[model samples]
Target: MDYASLKQKLQAFERQLDATLAALPSRQWASSSALRIASELYEIGAFKNSGTDRAEYLDYGYAILASHFVAGEVGYQADISREADLRQLIADLSFASHYYMIREYLYYSYNVPESMSWSFGEGRVEIRFSDKSIPRQFFTVYNDQMLGSQSHFRNFNHSAEIIRLLENEPEGVVTPNFETADPLMRAEADLKLAAYFSLIAPDSQIDLGGYSYAQFLNVYRMLLTKALYHRYLARAQDAVGAIYMPEGQLLDGIAGELGISLDIGRRILKDLVFDLDAAANRVDATYFSLMREGEPGGRIVMRPHHFATAEGLVNMLRVIAQRRPQTFLDRVSNEIGRAFVQRVKAAWEAEGFTCLSEVSLRDFDPKLPDIDLLVISCEPTLGYIIHVCELKCPVPPRWAKDQLKVLNKDSVSKAFRQVEVLQRFLRTEAGVQFLARVLPKEGHPHFRDFVVALNHLIITSDNAGMFFGAETTRAINFRTLERLLSRSDGDMALIQHILSTYDEHADEALVTTMVEFQLGSLTVAYEGVTASPLLEFPQGSWRSSPDRQAMVDAFIADGAHPFDVLELHPPDVVVNDHSIRVTADEEVPKK
Candidate 1:
């Protein structure tokens, strides 16, 4: 179906969902039913049933719920206590979710012909794709690579390491710093201080649904800890039943832990509980409510999935941070940038490089932006290579919809522009003079006449994906930079070589598709083009490059099944002065 037709279909299904939900008895019942269904899905491994995994299913469900129930506030209530009602509700929701999933998939995949052929049957949707399609092939390989990378980098330990680095910075650098090895301990201390700060400046304090940020964090931690304990119990003893703790007991425990009074703890508990009334029809409704007030005994009911894994806890915390007031986040972000720059400066100094942090170019020109970092390295061949490093420690995008925002020009435009300004300045006679003044020339007498090379770099805290081509600036993660530094061992030439040739290496590593077809006697070529290493392509037309079509055709037809997935082999990168070409595409083996 066309875009309009498919959108209409989606809207129709959405209306059906709304009608189904409207027939429910009460909003409370709907919430309970959703929770129950989620639990059942978890227990029966419904997430992993069929080819789709639990994570993907949950992601889709979360998106759908956030859009429909949360945003629209469609109160669909049902008496889940009735067996038949529960069963029918589950079946209805399941079918609606599956249908929505297919429609959403088809809607996004309209650009590719292969994705157009799909069928829904037996409460399941199946999509067929021609293996020859470049978009299909690119997405398959790119998704595998991205998933693997994301899994490795999104670990809690990785975040903890960054937190540790921030905490270790000088007292005035990262405010309310806690010098603790354990992330949880550090988090608690930081929250307490932040809460105190909030109280001191009530006018500027971030609103956490009436409770102080510290109180919110405290209650969340308590709930998460309890949920984790219950999860452990379930796993160890096969106890599938839900555990309810008395409100008084939970408050008492938190009060003791935080050295607060029972009254204060009780207030915090009230703040923490899922206020269905207050949050109704809000997008932030479901996620912020980790605990609900259980009926019959002033007990607390924790969401089963919120704290199921350490990763989940981290994700929830991340969401909370992201959802906070932008002003507060901006302040925190500035501090984080300072902390990261300090870390980078320290690392560079340790490596015996002359590194300048936050070098103000306004002294030279009022309009020029300040450089985050400037490194000067003296090489035997190039004499001196100046590295213009623009440091960015942006919070990685959380949702699937936000993923594309990472590569948006707006995100990195300032950094790129800053670097470009410096590069432009450096090429002038005044720039040479500025460089001569900035460069440490105590050892070398002939520094003035020595050849100089400038390498522009944008280094981030996390992998923001590969940005290649002439227009894009070279961006690398902190880990990669650390590796390069360690391997180079203060060799300027090696660093320059690697930094200069990074784009070429990345391009070789990620294979672009080139298809050839014989239309009668004429040969037509189709070249797959991607604007970024995120594997995003133009919607309407693929680029054409006839030169590589033969190679692609040969590679595909040489006893290798077109559908056989090709794994990305990272270049055997070595840090040295000598120029070397590295490619990551290995020939696929015959099936």
Candidate 2:
């Protein structure tokens, strides 16, 4: 369907939905007693097989209505009270709208709730049907409009079926209504179901006993939204293994088919992941809290947010489908790079290599950046080999060509600078801890003293010929790695040779990139070293004048001096030689 038609249809659907809302008997639905009774009917329908009698069918209707009333109540309330940011609120509404419309369509297309029963004689006696229509019709129609005609079967199907059944039956005989079946009795039954569902609902706040139908509706809508997103995600995921395109392409196609915008689709996907992160933190917190209290299970009611993140991933294929193939490729470069790393890791492991991915330097020093992948291969001839791979996913080939040489040059410069920073960080105490974290199992015991040869690798989708190679940071095309993997079985020599070339072509200064700032005149404790209070230098700066260092050394050694010399040199303020300032408070205490 064209976008215009799909939009128009959507608008029509919304109008129908509003009518459905207006049709609801709020006075009855909002009644506490009525909600309670409806809940009881739902429980009965859930656990028991009430035969196809009028009373049984009525019970089913009560269950369906009660479920909606409670859902609407919970969802509406949660939505109003949701403490999400503006973006989150927008996402929530989008999902809720999608969910609501889908549900409404399903209800109409399949004649649900209403289809569950056929009332003969205009509500005198209701008869049940196990199969009047299929819910799958809605799924097929939504994804492909031509597959099924949209129709509001409503009570029409039930009425027709009842008419047919009655016409076929003996004229004198009729479906009998249970003697005790009445609105009040059904209400009572519904209340009992409501109470039962309250006890069993995963979320306590959603329990009908304490919360109204409106509030419950809010939560219910969110849950349904999450569920629908998940449904699409699962379907798209199944396509990923079979499709040649990037994962996002598949998701995009699904979204387009569903008439959902790529932007909205992506937002849903992102929100899903964020929600999962939140859920994970909550679970961890719960686990720790319970452990502290010496408790078990925690019996936590999995919140809707916990499930939202997961369902959010369903948007991947639909959202990604909207991008140009090149854009999709560029965005997924990390995924491709990681895949290459995994393959390399596995190949090396088979050939005796240890590899680690996503090594963070922040563990030792909270300020340092992280390494993407670190592969360590021990050779019988060579001592220890550590390969640090930093990936730069280039722009789309077309864009790169159009943008000219400046982009390429900038990329090369940026990459070399990163290498310098990484080399500097590695020489610090933090780098020592980082090495410990990535050390191979066999090398763990001797990691502290292991003599290591480090090789830096820059993996990028860009061709290796695009920029000049650095001594420590050598660019390797992603395709080259793939080809090498395909050709070589387990040859350490081939890999070592490639890296040796990188080492040979690398600048000599890369080896000495890690430097220590030597304070020549300063005497420091082995375990504790502090700079002179008067001197200020940038973090990680190693440059120091020899004369200043000598003066510091003299100051440290002058124990026989009767007085101390204190100077103030703020970072931005420089102190001149032969200058002394004495405050009134420091004039020998006026003695």
RMSD of each: 16.0, 30.9
lDDT (tens digit, per residue) of candidate 1 on 53-135:
24334433433342222222223444436666656544444444454444433443443333334443344333433322223
Global Cα lDDT for candidate 1: 0.47
Error of 2 at 333 (Å): 7.1
Return the lDDT, model 2, position 16: 57
- Name model 1 segments beyond 4 Å from true: 1-29, 43-56, 66-224, 240-249, 261-281, 284-331, 344-353, 378-381, 400-410, 444-449, 461-470, 477-591
Task: Report lDDT (CA) for all predictions.
Answer: 0.47, 0.35
Candidate 1 versus the native: TM-score?
A: 0.55
lDDT of 1 at 271: 40
Per-candidate TM vs. native?
0.55, 0.29
